[model samples]
Target: MTLKDRIQEALKGALKRRQSVEVSTLRLLLSEIRYAEIAQQKPADDSKVLDVITKEAKRRRESIDAFRKGNRGDLVAQEEAELAVLMSYLPKQASREEVVTAARQAIEAVGAKGQADKGKVMAQLMPQLKGKADGKEVSDVVSELLATR
Candidate 1:
């Protein structure tokens, strides 16, 4: 089944199990998917739905970070729970080694030298890493590679 259908199915199961975090996270994700469809003026396919889910997961991560910084442990835990739920709908994440290897290749392909070529390398790398790796992790690897160069 498509990712969107899978998410809907999971939502129903969450509701039946009375898993509030899963239920609420799924609801929010579905809403975001719908909004993206509307904004794009077209129905969302599986890729588009995954994009929406990914965006929601990123937001949860950001919220968790911000809450932790503010010393709101309760909110951090809640956002982390939501992030875990959202991540279930995404493709398997790339391993750190895989991301680093790809970053190396991308930097070389773009002739990236030092920090100056950061954007150029990113432009070449992100599409390859999209849906496979986290952006921040890939960026960190890229920066580290350049710093060593």
Candidate 2:
């Protein structure tokens, strides 16, 4: 099944199970996916839907951080629950070692030598890591490796 189809199935299952939180989370994800489709002037493919899902997941993570900083434990828990639901649809995340290994290859391919080449390395690297690795983490690993040179 496509990612969208899987989400629809999950939404139906959530409704049947009377899991209100999951139903709502799935609804929100569907809405985001629709918006993304509209923005692209066509229906999103699985990877595009995954991108929308990933973006929503990232936003939820940021909100959880902000809520924690503001001492809004209640909001934090809600966001965390929502994030968990969203993540159920995404592919498993890449490990740090995998990201570092990819970054090393990217640096070599781009001939990136130091901090000034950060942008160059990232541009060449992100596509390889997209949806699997966090951009900031990849950048950090690339920067650290370059620093030692």
Cα lDDT of model 2 by residue, 35-145, tens digit: 988898998899999898889889999999999999999999999999999888887889999988888898899888788998998999898878887777888898899
Error of 1 at 123 (Å): 1.4
Q: Least lDDT summed over 10 consecutive residues: which range in candidate 1?
A: 49-58
Instruction: Give per-residue CA lDDT, model 1, range 2-110, as digits (tens).
Output: 8888889999998999999999888988899889989999989987887787778888888988998899999998999998888777889999999999999998899
Q: Which ten residues in a row have the lowest lDDT in candidate 2?
A: 128-137
C-alpha lDDT of candidate 1 relative to the true structure: 0.89
Clash count per candidate: 0, 0
